[model samples]
Target: MTTTTATAEATTATDVLIVGAGPTGLTLACTLARAGAAVRIIDKSPEPHRASRGKGLNQRSRELFDDLGAGAEAAAWGTERVTLRKYRDGVAIADTVAFGDRTPTPDTPYASGLLIPQWRTEEVLRRTLARYGVEPEFGRELTGFTQGADGVVATLADGRRIKAAYLVGCDGGRSPVRKALDVTFEGRTDTEECMVIGDVRVDGLDPAYWHQWFDEDAAVMLCPFRGSTHWQLQGMPERDADGRALPPSLESFQRLVDRCSRRTDIRLSDPTWFSVYRINVRMADRFRTGRVLLAGDAAHVHSIAGGLGMNTGIQDAFNLGWKLAYVVRGLASPGLLDTYEEERLPVAAWTLGLTEERLRAVTEGVKQAGVGTEAVVTDDVTTLGVGYSWSSLAWGGAKAGERAPDGPCGDGRLFDVFAGPHFTLLGFGRGSAQALAEAGEKCADRLRTCLVDDPTGHARRAYGIGEGEDALVLVRPDNHIALSAGADRGAEIADRLLRLGR
Candidate 1:
């Protein structure tokens, strides 16, 4: 039997209960609300985090931000690339660009990586979510919870009880929610390596260039963060004069800069935020149990290499958000929720391998005079190539489970049509419009139809449609290809849509 606290300080109910206020939780909460599901998010932190951690977003993540209505804000808050300048013993060793030049195609408008502090990104998301009248409840920590066959009852630190249809753990690496689920976080923590990272104000450093100084036994890097006067400082200390570990304070940071840069010209002061980061590589053995699930760092934690940690978490929330919303709204079967783990877990495992390789390459290069240690922002890191062709829900299309490529349709773009909480069907050539209209009419509230005649074949080319063959492409609310079929398969696609909620 479900229990409720009567005459308690507060008792609430919601469709989804999110247990963190970070980017992952915030993104999921906002997505759920936009999809017309009731959501409540809570955080243990009393105030918004001020640290400038996880300061990069790949191309795919930028597209997601655009879809979430925070794209313009994110673009305005970040720069494309901040060049990295490396120095050894006060002499310039190499200067390299962090991102490569990848030109935008018709199907891919956002083709480059973005650099924005994680705090600012969260601020944008939170501000957007506020427009929906949903805000994170601060100082409310999840103490424990119990799940029955029907729903979950979440308990908070302050004696409030919440009955939610589903609960999610977007809490960080040391997630209390993950622990309550009894899931093992299997991975290695590098006790041998530690880096002190913080946002600091320094004198005599150009804000345009990310500067790194590497000496025989000491290393320090300072990168300018956009929209702020502070630079993010990262350093590894060899040992103090007494052969002890260095303290994580402004004075010690100054010592690191002086020792590594071999100059007193640059001075460090006024550290606003700081943390000692030990590299950890781990993933939860299971992402879901009963009515509870995990996303972001609570599900998987990656090394800082390739800057995949935050971006992956943000994407994870995006992937699960629409599915959760659909299931909660009774528009889709509960089995849809199972696909969240099926799709995201393998991606997390792939990211772990990629980041591990990058970390190894960088460390090996650093040991060998920093010659080959330049971090390359490749296509893989941009995550444009990520696809799920193997998913069981995918069907009949040449690009099933692939990212629904954006293209020109009528006077606007494909994404503009895919925007909002609705699946989209695009049909091309003769008889396509009627077929798509018939299918779309069946799910009028949840589906939108678009037609492209493409007399000159631009739209057809962008969508990879061939000559003499009309095409039907179905895009999920998250902008991934769900099914692709010949124009004749419209009835078949409609049948599939009708079965979605069964």
Candidate 2:
């Protein structure tokens, strides 16, 4: 209800105050702003850095951007990676493998992963956020926050305060917001987290290929970056001569690369970014608390096996954005915010498990044997397939547990009939037209009802309707099929949301 401008007053207000301007926070801010929510996003850093971290944008994430009109721009920054060749035992045996078949079906537009580095992804998000007329408040940190029945209030380091209907923590693992909430972060560090990561400017190297050497003791990964022949090299860190884990000296880094590939011919110049680190797999206790919530790295973090970090966080923002905006706009009940945790928490846990499995595969020598590189890319669970197991609109009209597959559809236009993160009704034939019309009247604001372009009337039968037969499909905001029924009888659809929220 109130906000303040005085730094000494320590009170300001927003519909939502998001902490951390990384992929997750920024995405949520963009969505909320577009939907007309008063949002404020802050980060501890003063500026966006060029350090590229997670570098892969999965198919689902790209589709998410397309809905917001930024997909094409985001897509342009990434290159498609068809295969990842891993040579075992220091020998270059298995080569490049073809892996493109597993993508979006005809109904969906994006199917493949775009291999753009994380820094560029942030740049694209920044550009899109500007269109919303809200730029992230960098260098602004959340000192702590407390919640009340009406809203939440967050404090900045200089003692400024912000009041908001809700507060979301998308900050990284060392999240100040999450820490203030005192939520438990569970899971072990996988003690054998033997991984060293850094970026380097490699001269004279083809900046198109990803080279992996799974040698005797160490595993090395080299990815060629765009705009420069410089590559991002990652490998297991070696202990110093005294057995202490030391930073990778220039000589050690070059030697590690040389030993893994069995080649000292390629020279290593000054490194751009250098760091030796351990990988830990962890997730939060819960994603919500009263008016405060957690997302992205603040909620969960895992091994970077398939480049799922940024993608997972970005999706978290997508899942929470519309919900927060709708509630903020008073268009929906406040219960919608609960769905953010129910839907995204499982996704985070699933991703953690998937990445752990992949980490094991590489660390434990679990190879496909006969399955080539193509299989690995799809089999790599870091690429997501998240669904709402607890939302009200759980039944897709066609079948139970069947996702809303993007298809040629009852519509004639190729990829034209797209359902977004909301409720939609597709009427096939005129059979169930009455039912659709009736249902459309009840929830005109919450659901979309349309007659399928069925000239032959097969759509009506397929939708469980007789001649002039019409059936209804209820889609969730995430574009997943929830339920399909006759228009008048579909009142029970609201009951599903009740159960999910309760």
Candidate 3:
């Protein structure tokens, strides 16, 4: 790893400076770079992390990835609907399918979850980011920085200085940016509980199912990864008699398997990465401070029980990316950036509560036959139901701040039209032509107008517009409804956008 920073001048610059190259930072960097913005991403680690901690991609995150052009790559490398087989005291007690298959509807294109290692997810995102000619700089650590009214000047550990209009901390839980800003990360850590998670190869373990062995006190699980020899292992440790925690190692893991599964014949080998993670449930009091902000684990951390940690961070990056792009491009108001925190903070809090509830539900009850783990893996956890209905940007329509659904358009899906770095105005029927024309004239550079004149009424029903009742729905670049109204509110729509920039 090269530690020497470029010494061109004291005022090195970019449009956005991102600290950390994990899933969150990579997604934000990709989004900004794809929008023709200059972005620089740096990570302290010498190379990419190879842990398989987070393995599930929910429906909403999948759609976001699909929009970002990384979803297909992810789907190509991921597995679908692996069943969970539960055991107790060496006997196969129950069989449950945690991720069942589901068909896509006109409104929802991705109805099923995909399981892949988090490191692989980052690989696909990094590949997409490379298409924009932006690669993450490793071995560059953020030592300190200062932000002002105009821009931010960040100092790296290698004695480099970077000047950028915006600085984001996608760094993990111990975020330097958040700490420097003194933003309160409110939460508690379960010192009594720790899980040994790792990726390893095991003999005598079937690759077809997610093997789980659980009892009243301890559990060990091995989940198979697609197209790979490694399986993700999760095991609760048996504390010593003095109440001291045991260190994580292959030997300890073998003991866990022996004690929980009674499988002395199974041999574990090629242990790649492992950690005894102390469960932390935390969220920053706020997500922004001036031009510097936080996304992903920098802003929030949750228990891994529901697999929402990485997915929520990805969603955070998606929500913040376009808003930051618009403001940086001078197409929108600075206050537009404020909506990132406003819209996502509630969702983060709700996720914390939901995950805590699900964690308790799944761990406290009897290890029953056919006990549904569906609550943790269903559409709710997929974040398909997440919306910004209460945000200030939402007005006039019943589904404002909600996700703009996909429908049949021309020869492709409606999402195909909403694929790039531009907002879309969907006008239903001939009555909306005037509104579309006026809005198009006002925001011609950043907005695209699409008129759906289908006789089958699929598009109308997709957005819940009644027959012959014209409506106008404006979708943001992140595929959320920004404004919705009748055909006559063209002036109001234009005025709202202008006010948002103010």
Residues 1-502, model 3: lDDT tens digits: 1222323443537889999999999999999998888899999999998889889888888999999999999999887777888787777777766555577787787767888999899999999999999999999998988766677888888888889888999999999889988899999999987888888898898888888887767788888888888888988865788977787788888888888788778888999998888889999999998988999999999888778999999999999998888888887888899889999999999999988988887765536544534446655787887999988878658578988888888778788889888888988878899999998899887888888756677778867788889889889889988877899988888777666656
List candidate 2 segments past 4 Å from native. 1-12, 87-91, 101-104, 366-376, 379-384, 393-403, 409-422, 434-446, 454-469, 487-502
TM-score to native of every candidate shown:
0.94, 0.86, 0.95
lDDT of each: 0.84, 0.69, 0.85
- Backbone clashes (count) for model 1: 0
Ranking by lDDT: 3, 1, 2
Q: Which stretches of candidate 1 lie over 4 Å from their true place?
A: 1-12, 238-244, 367-373, 453-459
Q: Per-residue alpha-carbon lDDT of model 2 for 1-502, expressed as tens digits?
A: 2222224433436899988888888888888887788999998898886666777787778767776667888777677754555666555566563345555444445657777777778888888889988999988877767677778777788788778888898889878777777789988775444566667766544455677776555667777656544566777777868656657665777778788777756667766667665677789999998888999999998887666888889888887887887787766788878767777787788888887776666555534332222333554443434667465435544443234544444445212354343466666545657766666776666566666675565444443456654456665555556676665545566555444334
RMSD of 2: 4.4
- What TM-score number comes out for model 2? 0.86
lDDT of 2 at 6: 24
Instruction: For model 1, give the 10-residue run with minimal summed lDDT.
Output: 1-10
Give the per-residue lDDT of model 1 (tens digit) for 131-242.
Answer: 8889999999888887776688887888888988899999999998898888999999987678889989889988888888766677889988787888899998546686
Candidate with the larger lDDT of 1 and 2: 1
| Shift of residue 487 alpha carbon in model 3, Å | 1.8
Tell me how many clashing residue pairs each candidate has: 0, 22, 1
